[model samples]
Target: MGLIVQKYGGTSVADAQRIQAVAHRIAQRYQQGDQLVVVVSAMGNTTDRLIQLAYQVSPEPEARELDLLLSTGEVVSCTLLAMALRAIGVPAVALTGAQAGIGTDARYGRARILRVDPSRILSHLREGKVAVVAGFQGITEEMDITTLGRGGSDTTAVALAAALKAQRCEIYTDVEGIYTADPRVVPEARKLERISYEEMLELASQGARVMHNRAVELGWVYKVPIYVASSFTEAPGTLICLQEGESMEQRNKVVGIAHDTDVGRITIRGVPDRPGIAAAIFTPLAEAGISVDTIVQNASVERLTDLTFTVAKADLRKAVEMVRHVAQEIGAKEVLWDDVMAKVSIVGSGMQSVPGYAATMFRALYQAGINIELITTSEIRITCLIDASRVEEAVRALHRAFQLEEG
Candidate 1:
């Protein structure tokens, strides 16, 4: 019998009925003789509701306490799931991230997994018990509770799979599978049967929500195969693995289009363009854990230049404050930011080897009358920041331009 690791998102076990349904699915797998380890997120909007409750009591909650509060949501779901499994006559036990041997650095809201001992989980498995793990959280070196950021459950599952040397990691979520584009945005978007790890990494990083980017990164590094499918359906799902020796001519040059509406752009206008200026402004944001994306610097006119970058909208206030402080120190003019920005990207491994992908993407956006505020590219992706209002249009235009629907 092979060992398997599975992760269920918040939606899959949102309530009593859903939790029971998931238990049945696990029971079936267990009955088939495969040892199972399950990782689960907080139920439904439990994390959000908890955050709201915390803010109601305090404007800025303490990070350690907030993490401790947030971690309970997953614990509740996991225990309920364990009880459900036992009710169905399946041997099961609930374990928190720490009990499951997940250790992390003390980053509080965004901790990174440092190690997984897996001894406790292995004991449960040996006893013919399913180990139900609370995902998204772990213990710090100091024994304080810490949580990985949003979608951290995915990381937890993949990390466990890697440590346990499971045959495969299955991620059960609300969506049927990974699509050419978000089907809600593009009606004709097709589901991909398989995708390369590199392609999936780019898609997830570019804002595809089906899989967490960090999880994909871990899966790639460990060479672990991940299966993504819906928890509510029996439909065929997508397999993310290494690229096979297939005819290059048979593959689509553009694998998918990803868009993010949670974009915030910051422009530091009239900055003195000089060595160490960019570092001076961006170093503090990095130390503050604010992720900056799609930076653009205009040519210096009279030794003065404009520097622009994008961050998540939720981070706009803190990012701007940090930049403004740096701006004054660097003798800059004004710090400006726009919260209503969106980015749409086209991603495929073969795009860089082809000549016309960029021109095609730009032409499509131009034809759709979407103003391109800024542009960025990697070896396999091209991202354009545009007015949030025009994001859907931009995605559809690019999807059609890349002919993704035909697949």
Candidate 2:
């Protein structure tokens, strides 16, 4: 039987009773003759509470000290989970990320998993012990505890799966699985039984939040099978994998629509459309670590062009300042910032060869009474910047237009 690596979110094992429930589920899987490795996040709200505590002590807490502070959250979960499994008569061992040999870069926050040794894990498995690892954390080269950014637990799980060459990596979250669109917005959106990794990457990047985009990219690179399932239900979740040789050729024509509500548009007005002007305007924003999406440039007249792009609302100020600075230096007239934007995207492995997909998307949005502010397209995704208030309605309309849900 193939070994499986499963990662549970904070909500999955939040309290003592919840931990006991997880133990029962794990024990059943253990009885199935499959060796198991479990990764877990901190208990619900624990990390936030820890951060709050740190802030109570100091408003500008040192990063290194903060990492030290936050790492304890997962340690508590791992130890408790191990105890719960043992109480259920299963032999299990809890390990910190360092103990599990999760080696990452020296970055304090948002560090990337560079490698996994897992010798300690293998030893435990050989001794007939299940191994539980703390997720979203790793030890740096300097032996410093570093925290991965948001949804880092998913990356931790996927990284371990790649390391151990496990049969598949299961991400246990609060949601059932990948949907045509977020079910909260599009209630009729169906859970995708199987989704291509590329499509999932687009979905995550567009604010799925169920999984992080970097984790999906790593899975794609490592050819690891990822299963996204709900922790609270028996419903089967979505399996994300590489398409077969031929499936790649036909799968991307039209897939699913993804939408994000946290978008703000920045327009750099009256900028000279000259060499390095666009670069100058965007370079500082890039330096400030903002993810810009849906970039558009209107036709330049004489020498000036209007440039626009979307960045996360959280980073709106930083992005605005950076661009405004560049605009001043370039003698541009003004910088316009619009925070009322949302992104609606359709991603599929099947769109490579499809013609008129753009027209199809436009016609659907038109019928839905949605106005598109900015438009961007790639080989597999067609995205639009629309009014943030209408994001859900636009997503539902697109989901229906693409027939992404079952009848």
Q: Which prediction has the highest lDDT against the true structure?
A: 1
- Per-residue lDDT for 51-134 in model 1, tens only? 999999999999999999999999999999999999999999999999999999999999999999999999999999999999
Q: Write down the RMSD of all candidates, one decimal each.
A: 1.1, 2.0
Query: For residues 278-311, could you state the per-residue lDDT of candidate 2 as single tens digits?
Result: 7787778776667787788999998899988888
Model 1 lowest lDDT segment of ten: 244-253
The TM-scores, one per candidate, come to 0.98, 0.94
Best by TM-score: 1
* Global fold similarity of model 2 (TM-score): 0.94
- The lDDT per prediction is 0.94, 0.87
